[model samples]
Target: MFNKGNKGLFALVLTLFMLTNFVSNAQEGESIFNSKCATCHAPHKDMTGPKLFEVRQKWEEGGAMEGSLHQWVKNWQVAAATDPYAKEVSDWAPSAMTLFADLTDEQIEAVFDYVDEQPKGGAVADAAGAAGGGVASNIATEENDFGWIWYILGAVFLVIIFSVGGVKRQLQELDEDADKQVKVGSKVWVFKNRKYVGIGVLVLVMAGVVWLFLGLYQIGVVSSYQPSQPIAFPHDIHAGINGIDCKYCHNSADKSKSAGIPTTNVCMNCHKQIQGAGDQVEKIKNIYASAGFSPEGGGKYSGETEPIIWNKVHNLPDHVYFNHSQHVEIGGIDCKQCHGDMTKQNELPRVVPVEELNMVEGNIQLTRPTLTMGWCIECHNVKEVSTGTLEGKGGYYDEIHKRLLENDESLYEEYLEDGKVTVNELGGWECAKCHY
Candidate 1:
C-alpha cells in the first residue's frame, strides 16, 4: 500500500510539471511569432508566406508538412525532397527564406501552438480585401490626377493676359505723350537719356550671358526621355500582371554591380515550351531565329549564336559608380521604385520627367539626381533599417545592425527597444554610400 501511494504521488507531480511546461511554451510561441513570423506569415492569412493554419493541413495531406517543416526552416533543399508542399510554397515565393536553425525547440513549438489557435475567417478576408482595395485606389488616383496640368494651364493663361494688358497700357502712354517735342525714334531717345539707355543695354547683356550659361548647364540632361526598345519589353506585363520577379530576368542585381540583361538563352529557356505568345509568338520567334533555333520543331544548328543588341536608354557617365545590387538587394528598394510600372507601358517608356531629373544626369548620366540632391538625401535621412530579429521579414539587416553596434552603442541600445534600426540612423545618407 505504501509503495503504491508513493508511485501515485510521483505520477501526479510529473503530470503537473508537463502541464506547466506546455502552458509556458504556448505563451513563448506567441511572443516569438509576433517578433519573427508575423511580418510574412499569419495564422490564417497569406502575405509573403502562406497562411500557417492551412500549411499544416496541406502538408499532411500532401505528405510533406511534418518532417519537411523542420528541415525547410533549417535548409530549403533538404526539405525540398519528398516534400511537394515545400516545393509548391517555394515556387509561390521565389526568394528563399533566411535559415532559422538558431531558433530553440521551445520557440518553434510556441510558434506552432500559436498558429493552431489563430481565429481563421476574419484575418484572411481582411488581408485579401485590403490588398485588392490598395491596387484599385492606386489606379484611381493616377486616372484622376489632372490637377497639376490644369494648374499650369491656368497660370499660363494669366501670364498671357497680364502681358497683353501691359502692352496695351504702354501703347496708350506713348499715344498720350505723342504731342511732346521729344521724338520716339530710337536714336533720339538714346541721345536724350544716354545714361538710362546705357544702363538698360548693360542689364540686357548681363541677363543674356546668365541665361546662356544656365541653358548650357541643362543641355545634356534627359529626364523623361522614353526611347523605343528593340523588343517591346513590357515591364507592366512581366512585373505587375504576370508577377515575374525583377530578379528572375535581371538575375545579376543581387550578385553583381550591374543588373545584367537577360541572355537570349534565358528567353529560350521559357520560350521553347511557350513558343506561341498569344499573337506575340511571331515576335518571340524572331528571337529564336536570331539565337539559331527552329521554333516549329527541334532543329539543332551549329553552335553559333548572335545576341540581340538592346539600346541602353539609361546610361550613366563613366566617372560615377552605381551598383544596382546595392540599392535593390542590400537597401531593399523595389525595382518599381526606380523603373516605375513597367507592365503599364507597351514599350519601356522613358522614365517620367519627375524621376529623370530627380535621379539621373549627364551625357554619362552622373549621379547628380536631377530632381535634387536634397531629395535623395531626404530618402536616406528618414528611412529606417530593419533589425534581423523582426518577425516575418528575413534578417538581412543583421550585418548593418552589427555595424551600428560597433559605432554607436547608445543608438544600438535604443534600437533594441523597438527591435529595429532605420536606414537614416545608420549612416545611409553619407555621400560615400552612393557617390563613392
Candidate 2:
C-alpha cells in the first residue's frame, strides 16, 4: 500500500536509527571502560587483567557458564566463588579486580561490544606526527639559513673594510714625502711609549690567561641544558597547581638511580577526563594515541600504541655510580635539594646553574659545576649528618655514628670540628665509594 518514495524514506530512517543507537551504546561503553575498567583491562593487550578483545567468545569457548562473564564484570568475587571458570580467570592477575555491583548486564555487554570493534594495529597518528615533523624541519632549515646569511654578510663586510683600508694605504704611500716622514717618526714615537706599551702588553697577557682558564672551566660544565620534550608537561601545573606529589609519577626515585618516566597510562589516570585545550591538546593527544585511546565520543581503546621517545636531560658517565635511594630514602634529602622546586618550574626541568641554585631558598651553596665530583665532595663536606637522618630506615647510619662516638672518639671530635658529622666523615670521600 505504500508508495516507492515512502518506502525509500522508511529504509533511510531505519538505517539512521540503527546507526544512532549503535553509536550511543559505544559512547556509553567507552565512558564506563575509561572510568572503571581502564585501570586494569586493556582492549587487546594483557595488563592487570586479560585482554578483552573477543573476550566473550573466548569465554564461551573456554566452557564458562552462560552469562557468567557478565556476572564477573558485575562482581568478580561472587563470580569466582560460584563458577570454576571465573575462579581460574581471577587467578591470572594476583591483584583482585574491584567489584562493580552497580554495573548492569546490558552495560557489561555494551562494553564487550565496544571492545570487540577495536582495531588490532590501533590508531596511528601518522598525519599528526608527519605535520609536526614537517614543522620541525622547516624551523631547523630557517635557523640554519639565518645563521649562514649572517656569516656571509660578516665576511662580505670584512672584505670591503680590508679592501678600502688597502686602497687608502696605497693612496697614502703615493705621497712619498708623507710616507718617509711617517716611517722614520713612527718608531721613535713608539720607543718613547715603550714602558707604557710593555705595561699594556703585560695587562693584556694577564687578561688572556684569566679568560683562558674561565673558558676551560666551562668546557664540560653543561648547566641550564634544557632539551625539548615531546610533551611540555608543566611541573608547575601538576605539582604546584594540582598538588600531585613527585613520587606519584616518578615512582622509582626512592627505589632506583633513575627517576623513571611515567608511562602513558599514568598520564591517563586524570587525562581521561581532562582533555586539554590549545597547544597542550596536541601533546596530550599524543599520550592518548600512545595509550591506544580515542579521546572523542567518550573515549575507547584502539589496541595500537607507540612509546614516546623522550630525550635524556641529565646524563651521567658510565663510570659513575649513583643510587637515588641512598640520598632520598636513607638521607631523607628533599628532591628540591638537587632538582630545583618543580612547583615553580614552568618548563621541563634543566640542570639549574650553581648561581641560580644558590638563589633557591634552602639549597646548600656549592662553587663547583653541577653534578661534578667537586660538587658532590663539597655537599658531603657541608651537609649535617643529623640524628634523625643517621637513625634511618636500616639503622646502619645510627650504628656507624655510635661506633664513631664510642670507639673512635678522637677521630669523631676532629670530624665534628665544624660542629656536625658531615658525609665526608662517614667515608663519603673514599675512592671506592663512587668509582667502583
Candidate 3:
C-alpha cells in the first residue's frame, strides 16, 4: 500500500475481480432465467409477463417501497398488501405472476441485471441468425468441396507415380549395362502382369457397382432440403429467444396423425398487440392480410381474407404409415428427436440430416439417412417403449405389458433380457407396422 507498484497491482487485481464477478453473475442469471423465467419473460419484449428490462429502476422511480421488488418476486401478494406500487403492478396483467419463493434476493437482482444489460429489439435475433447462417453456409461449402477434394488427391497420386517412374528411367539410363538389357513395350508389360491387372479391374468394377447402387438408394433421400416459403418465419425469434413451445403452434400433434400448421388466427393472437417494425412489418402485414386484420383505426378485422398455403416440409411416401399422436402422446418422444433443434433455425424448416439429429443431445445415434426406412428401423430397435419406468403412465404399451405378463411370463421375461422394452419388441418392425 505504500509503494506505487504495489498500489497499481492492487488496483489491477480489484478490477479483475470485479470483471470476473460480473461475468459469473451474468452467466448464472442467464442459466436461472432459462430454467425458470424464460417461459414467460423476455428482456426487451412483453411475452406472458411484462418486459424485465430496467424493471428494477422502473420500480424505484415509481416510488416502490424499499426491498419491495425482491419481496414481490418471492410473493407478489405479500408485497402488494404492503406497497401501493406493488398493488399497481399486480393490476397490470390479468394473468398472475408465478411465485419464486425459493429465489434469493441476490438471484433476483442478478436476473434483473442480465435483463437490463440486454441489447434492445432484434439484436439477439440478429446475432443468433448470423451464427445459424454461418453454420449452414459452412455445411454447404463442405459438401460442395468434397468432390473436388477427391479429384485433387487423385491428381497428386498420379504426379507421385510419374515422378517415381522418371527417377527409375534415369537410373536405368545411367547404368553401364543398360544397353545390353532389353526394354519391354507398354503392351508387353501389361500382358506379363495380366493376372494383377485382371484383379485390379475386377476390384474397380465391384467398387463402381457398389457406388452406383448407393447413389441409386440416395435418389429420394433429401436431407437438408429447404424449400422457399411464402412467409419467411423467424423460428429463432419465436421459439429460441421468446421461448414459445413447439406444441403451441403445432397444437394437434398429440391428437392427430399430423402436427397441424397453426391458423392465421393463432398468429393474430400475438401480432394484434405487437404490430412489429422494420422487415418484420412486411411479414406481419402478410399475417394481417391472411387473418383479415387491419391495424389502422384501432385494429379491426375485415371480412375479406386470403388463405396462406404452407408448403409441407417433412413428407413421407404414401406407402409409409406414421402416427404423430402415437409417437408424441403415447410413446412420449420429444419433437427434437427427429426434427433437430428448431429454436436455432432462422430459415424455413428443412429435412434435418441424421448426422445433425445424432449431434443433438439425448437423440439416439443413427447410421442411416433421415426420413428413410432404415432410419426408422434403427430408431425402433433402440428407442425404449417407456422412459425410465412403466409404473404410473397408462397407455396401449401398459396393456400390452399386462397381457404379456399374465399370458406369457416367459415371453415377458425374454423381452426383459435386455433390461428394457423397445418398440421393435411390440411389432414396430413388423412389415404391416409402417407399410400400408
List the candidates' TM-scores in order. Answer: 0.46, 0.56, 0.57
**For candidate 3, lDDT tens digit of each residue in 58-159?**
999999999999999888889999999999988888566666676888989887876675667544323323333111222222233345446534543454
> lDDT: which candidate is best?
3
Tell me how far candidate 1 lies from the true structure as C-alpha RMSD in angstroms: 33.7
How would you encode candidate 1's per-residue C-alpha lDDT over 1-436 as one tens digit per residue? 3232223334433443443354455445643454345545656666777777756566777767666877775566667766787887688877655456556665666678666865555442344334431122222222222333355335434543443344345445555676774765653454456457446544543554354335333423445645434566667766777788878888999878998888988887777776654868767867777688775546554566666756445544322457776667666766655665455656565645544433433211224443344435666654544644444243556666666667887878886665555666666666676563
Clashing pairs in 3: none
Off by over 4 Å in 1: 1-184, 191-199, 226-228, 277-279, 298-302, 349-352, 355-378, 387-425, 429-431
Which candidate achieves the best TM-score against the true structure?
Answer: 3
- Candidate numbers sorted by lDDT from highest down: 3, 2, 1
lDDT of each: 0.56, 0.66, 0.70
How do the candidates rank by TM-score, highest first?
3, 2, 1
Between candidates 1 and 3, which one is better according to lDDT?
A: 3
